[model samples]
Target: MASIYDFEAETLDGRPAPLSAYKGQVVLIVNTASKCGFTRQYEGLEALHRRYRDRGLVVLGFPCNQFGQQEPGDAAEIASFCALTYDVDFPMMRKIDVNGPKAHPLYAYLKKAKKGVLGTEAVKWNFTKFLVDRDGQVVGRFAPTVEPKALEGAIEALL
Candidate 1:
């Protein structure tokens, strides 16, 4: 029984980011893109982070270019775009493949925990979100169309 905390990834700055560091906190892990139509969702994600950070919610963004090459920027460029365009303050991870042999291990676990529509394990697009409980268990999987604000209730329940 591996918990979400068992995984590790790199931050935008290429530093190791252990999910264990987020233990006891409700986490929203989202795969993001800079040039996609859903890029504006970054603002909503930031809002969710600000609104519930004190209540034990943390939003983590992971940039991915797997889908349609929507996120073609390097780590530095992605960070700048997130900060300047959406004022995103949530922890943003380094770009990684989200749906292939090179997919991040964390993502592999998440998809196994919660499959998408029609029981598909593969992520259909960017902005897909995985919600983890305080116990480090992945509790939910949201589609790209699910707005960040709409997750307030679920986050509140975990808090």
Candidate 2:
């Protein structure tokens, strides 16, 4: 049924990754940016990953430069920044577009499955987050302004 397992993405190093590897794990898929105002959320996201990874929760970050070019950096640079700034240990995908024609297919499917505020499918900005269940179904969508710590309860419930 076109589950997330059907999608293949590139890692921060540009290596191919199939979502099937994360099956049966609750995943928090977030579109992120390094220079945006919402960049601080990386800390909270990493915290969530560290806290619940033992409980089968995986937080995946997908860097996107679409929103005002806030994430203008190559994979290595982004990886380094994330590691240094937030101590992020979770997996992160290569830079991708989350909206418009260049949008990644996985993101397109996620958007269709769970629209944001006012039935909008197009992402409004950076740090837009999607909560996915063990079955790879999208369960919720959080706006960019929504702080990452605010998702702890929802994430715990899913885990």
- Candidate 2 off by > 4 Å: none
Tell me the RMSD of model 1 versus the true structure: 0.6
Candidate 2 CA-lDDT value: 0.93
**TM-score list, all predictions:** 0.98, 0.97
lDDT of each: 0.94, 0.93
Q: Indicate the TM-score of model 1.
A: 0.98
Candidate closest to the true structure, highest TM-score: 1
Candidate 1 residue lDDT tens string, 103-145: 9999999999999999999999999999999999989999999
